[model samples]
Target chain A: MTGWLGSLRERAARITPGTLLVRGAAFVFAAGALLVAFPGEILLWPGAAVALVACGAAPALAPRTRLTTMVLFLAVGGWIVATTTYAEPVTWARLATLACLLYLVHTTAALAAVVPYDTVVAPAVLVRWLARTAVVLALTVGFAVASVVGVRVVSGQAYLVAAVAGVLLVAALAGLLTLSRRS
Target chain B: MADGSLGGAGDEDGWVPTRAFGRAILVVGVLVLLAALTGRYDLVVLAAPFALGTALSLRRRPAALPAPELSTMDARIVEGDDFAVRVSVANPDPVALDLVLVRLWLPRWVRVRDADHPYAAPVAAGSVAEIDLSGTALRWGRHDVGPLSLHGVACDGLLVSLRVECEPLPIKAYPATDPFRADEAMPRAAGLVGQHHSRKPGEGGELAGVREFSPGDRLRRIDWRVTLRTRRVHVVSTLSDRDAEVVLLLDVLHEAGESGGTGGAASVLDTTVRAAAGIAEHYLHRGDRVAMLEYGFRARRLRPATGRRQYLTVLEWLLDAKPAGGADQPSTGAFGAHLLSANALVIVLTPLLDQRSAAMVAGLARSGRFVVAVDTLPPSLRPPTDGAWGPLADRVWRMSRENVIGLLREHGVPVVGWAGAGSLDHVLRDVTRLASAPKVGRR
Candidate 1:
């Protein structure tokens, strides 16, 4: 049993360091951003800030510490979202800020996963990352604005279209994760 | 492991996903579903950026392999000269590669001037991106520059192509030495044709003497001034200028002391090779046939030849010398008197560490060939240890070496320590004088 556990640990370690932590941090930061974006959620601002900071600082810590911090911050974010009521209406500005913050969280993790602490980030790599980030941010903000306007304009059917879009998004995310794992 | 594997010259394929895309997709998908279920539209807006990024990345296929070619400015460089190596990457497709990383493997003796190796650049489709690496040649001998390594990524940073390695390029660096010209006369002029004044009287430019015209003498050879004064015709006799054969016997039996490269004190082998090059350059410059015999290892021989190009051949062979099997035992049977032309000058370059070489050289001198043993022992060699006994032992070894040198001198083989230009001047004159004296035939 101990040998089996050791082998399992070895296999987990073989996965790129900080990959899981970064992924988990992305989820937590997005959740925290959602809580902060909702109306009357001023108290959850600290949680969102804490999640962002943890993800940004995750690259410098040991794998175990990063893993623990990511899990704990994610649980805190889940708690913040669960306690808040679902009746709060969303605004365009709040939704845009949430999209930007979520993008930042994802980017922090993605950048940390590729580069190790000892490595010097080449200027070419940095420029490429920044360019890609800009494109992704532009696309996400455009879609987010369209979705918000669609919800306000077509109140009844907006939920049905969102459910279908949500299902498609889940499938895309699952496929992407599988593809990344295979690579 | 990454660096070590990259050191090999060749192409390899590898792929790594930008976790940013995966993380964004996964995080946004879950958040979008939660928002849709709870009738919250703001979550859809938050997921849009990641969703768009993933869609864009997955929509386009990865760019085709960017084949790169590596070339150096010069294939050969002299010591202390700069060499430029250029790596050019070509994009085969219409799309552009955002960032590419290139690493070059460098040998120990080469130093880059700009330290611009491991460069990164963006290459457009159908366009070539180039990186120039300039370095200096720090030491002599052939050195290999690289097997170029390349890493390329696409615009989205989602896909990384394989690490491509190219073959290592070779740079031949020739040993630089001071200019050497021998002013001393050759002991004997053996060739029937070419330069250098021979003692024997024959048809030539330099007047040896004027004598009463003989029956066979050409009328044009008559010295007009001397013939007018004598009334009877007097003919001018000149010393014939002919080429001489020079055989350089390089002793490679033993190599002592450390070879501190070109910057520090030279080892025994370094001294031997350099001195041989200098002497060969001098003789070949004088239009004399020069050959080389590397002894004290497996015997390597070069046939006697005279020309400007022959010097390069001699140097190339000399640079390949290494301390190998013993050349002292005379087991090869190739180092006979026949190898040396009649009256050819035999120069034996040895460290004099092997006592048997001394006897071998003396035998050549006794056979009527002019032999000169050049001592190539480094002058600045230190003792084996720093203790008192080390100095004493060194002195004792020196005294014994002198004794061995004395024995060679007794047999009429003049042993001279190489110290640049005029080192062979005195001994060459002595050998010339000895060659002129009347000799008794071997009984």
Candidate 2:
């Protein structure tokens, strides 16, 4: 009993205020992305959103696992299914917001995995991480907007362009992986 | 150190890709393929950040591993004194490290505040990040500060370097000497010159007697008052102020009770060591030669010397006085001759836990040594109280130990329980008187 209590106390000491904030941000972003995907449904009442919210909140429990990736993909898959099946209007602003939220979830969860619970993290580390994340989000939005405007300029068959764009994107991803392996 | 569990080092030397990197590629590929087949162009917005972020982060992989340096104060420090262990992790690569994780390992005797947990910090390119862990050492001994483990996480946790280990630093924590003062003369003065006064009449500060003027007696020593009173030429005589040799005999045959360190409850070894240090410091400061000897299997000894340097050496010797099995009578008797001087005062610090310690004390006294047996067992220590006869057993043990102490004292060895300052004064006074008395010569 004493050993158990001591281990508990040891684990408790490892939780710092900074760790709490990062984990809290991970949970909020995950739950928020899922909620935004399913509009007009109560957070607790909807079966699909609640289940996806649980998956999103997995990072709060164990951020270092592949669970965070699973949650992000599940929420995106849910969003894609809801939009296409129900014929909801796909606004670029909504897409961008969802994109930022999903990215934020990934960024925060990744930070949580590396930083120990009891770490005396320097303020500059978090500030710099947030700054980098902001830069990435802004640049992503710029490239996204440019792609959208460029696609609008093309007249005629949208599905044909989508097929070509998707193939190119897949090829680019495969190339990135290959290059990363070499580096 | 990089454990094999961390996949050791790859062809990149230190860098290992993280789960986030693989997740990014997989998620981006799946989303774009699904969007292309489903004819939904807006899905590209969701996939854009993952692709862009991974691409930008991977643009720079650290070419060199982080360097971790651990440093501590190497000089000897007293127990319970606050000390700091400095740890610095330097990033030599051009890429800024997103996070650096550091873990510290310390000996059981050391208590570094908040160092029980790992630390994380950021080091910019070609810069160093430092963490100072400060705390008190709780006991006396040679201890290691840390074998600090360090690793760097860069590219937003997409990659990590293999652990960089810094070797542990040896720190000698000397026992904290208690305030001990003995307001009595040493029983014997065996050395040529120092603080304690000797019996023989000589040129010194302590007056021995007033006698009639004799040949070779300097006029400066002439006592006018004594000459006038006696109506004869008289001179003041003084005892020679010679140093004494104090041999601290630590009985390391048995160690009893728990060592709670410094301010906590002391065990037999703790009491013995602290008392020995205090006693040595007191006599050494007063210009007396101090020596040390262990009675266990090792039977280590330090020669008698008077100085600040000997005091430090004595503390160093005390750290190695761990308990071992008993030395046979013949071995103990053989060492008794060389390790002891004719007029040296022997202070034996023992727990008196068994017959061997009591026999050793008796043997020293029988050998005509002016031996003082200091009972070093903590007063609060008690036997196990778990079974039906626990209290009874404890009572019997106490009675037995008291009997041994009684026997030792009856054999002319002064057995006294160690209390700080002035604890040995009465016994020392009696021993000094005994030394001044006449004794029969052994043929």
Which candidate ranks first by lDDT, i.e. highest? 2
Looking at candidate 2, what is the lDDT of residue B404? 86
Q: In model 2, which runs have C-alpha deviations exceeding 4 angstroms?
A: A1-13, A39-52, A155-157, A160-183, B1-12, B225-231, B325-334
Q: Write the per-residue lDDT of candidate 1 for residues B306-399, one digit (tens) a residue.
A: 8879888888877677786554444647667767787789889888887677777877887788999988888887657677788788889889
In candidate 1, position A31 carries an lDDT of: 50
Q: On a 0 to 100 scale, what is the lDDT of residue A158 in model 2?
A: 53
* CAPRI quality of model 2: medium
* Candidate 1 Cα outliers beyond 4 Å, as residue runs: A1-130, A147-165, A170-183, B1-48, B93-95, B114-117, B209-212, B230-232, B260-264, B325-331, B334-338, B356-360, B366-368, B386-388
Residue B123 lDDT (model 2): 90
Worst 10 residues of 2 chain B by lDDT: B1-10
**Evaluated with DockQ, which candidate comes out highest?**
2
Candidate 2, B1-443: lDDT as tens digits = 11112333343567876667677777788888777877766666678788878877877778788999887764478999988788888898888899789988989999999888788889989998888888788999888888888888888887877778888877889999977999798887876677877767787899898899999999999999989988999999998888888999998888888999988999898999999999999999998888898887777889998899999899999888787764443374545745689788999999898697788789888888999999998899977799999999888888888888888889888988999999999999989988889987699
Tell me how far candidate 1 lies from the true structure as C-alpha RMSD in angstroms: 8.0
